[model samples]
Target: MARMPLAERRRQLTEAAIRAMTRDGVSRTTTRSIAAEAGVSLSVFHYCFDSKQALLESVLTMITDHYIAVVKEAIRPRATLRETVRAGFQAYWDHVAARPAEHMLTYDLTQYALREPGFEHLARRQYELYCETYAQLLEQLGRQTGFELLVPVPVLARYLAAMTDGVTLNFLVLGDADAAAGILDMVTDHVAGLIRER
Candidate 1:
């Protein structure tokens, strides 16, 4: 219908794939359906992606990118490290509250990747991305705020990633926003305690 760059087309297809997977499921969603969701021909989907693994990778990355962008924006230097950290965590929680389907799709995609033959690496890649995102965010915050962390960045990053993953999953399972917020506050305080003014 309209001329678009390959990168843009791939992004479009990736978003469409997310919707298709969230609605139908990773195992049930077909490339043909993704093409239909994106209003593109199957050939266009093929042109953008070589295989299901590639599409799955794109979908996972897109989902992570979505919240990372929000958290990065929310994490900009604040009056205090606790405030900044809380803002970032709150931003992510808001996204989960608003788009539970998308968040749930991420968990589903991970399980699908892990269980499917020849796609276990996608699940690993998903967790790696999570850890990497936390590490990058920690580095960026440190640079911006000039705070020293008692915990090493790598260790802290993994811990934060695992903690947030569990919290999100807990909220998803319980559907309790209040409990999620309280847990987030506790974790935020714990994390803020890990940092000291340089």
Candidate 2:
């Protein structure tokens, strides 16, 4: 294959960094390791990312984008509200299970963001954006289908999103997908009940 251009190389390096962090946690994904993984020199890594934090922030964004896509793809208009919600949860669970180590990377980046003023703000805004977007989608679906949403769509969406995050964290902490899946089932049932109520 032809050599990748600088722009492509930068993107490749960033993606490789994300993969490394997901596999080994952020602390273990040093600049050297990322450079090695990307088949580039340490100097190239620095040239692309001024600091490790910058690289990590970029990788975090990539991971977040991947996760958001997973959630979006799971929302099928043909499905009932409850099934849509359950499918969303299952998609999230599968995302975690597909690359369990990525959960650690996500948690680590979350913790890392907590310490930085800029990243903290971005994290908060991103989460709020997700809540708003999903809430609106759920509300529209409810209105379109005449489904009795258990809670207002806005609140329900936020709650489900939070539950999804909580489940991911639990799996990361316990290293037990089974336990996480069981808890997810309970959360799913509660969400379904909310929408199913008359």
Best by lDDT: 1
Misplaced by over 4 Å in model 1 are: none
On TM-score, the candidate that comes out on top is: 1
> What lDDT would each prediction earn against the true structure?
0.94, 0.73
Cα RMSD for candidates in order = 0.9, 3.7
Per residue, candidate 1 scores C-alpha lDDT tens digits across 1-198 of 998999999999999999899999999999999999999999999999999999999998889998999999999988888999999999999999999999999999989988999999999999999999999999999999999899999999999999989999999999999999999999999999999989
Q: Candidate 1 clashing pairs?
A: none
Q: Candidate 1: RMSD over Cα atoms?
A: 0.9
Deviation (Å) of 166 in candidate 2: 1.6
Q: Which ten residues in a row are the worst by lDDT in model 1?
A: 72-81
Candidate 2 displacement at residue 20 in angstroms? 2.7
Model 2: weakest 10-residue lDDT segment is 136-145
> Would you give me the overall lDDT of model 2?
0.73
**Candidate 2 structure quality by residue, lDDT tens digits, 42-61:** 98888888876677667766
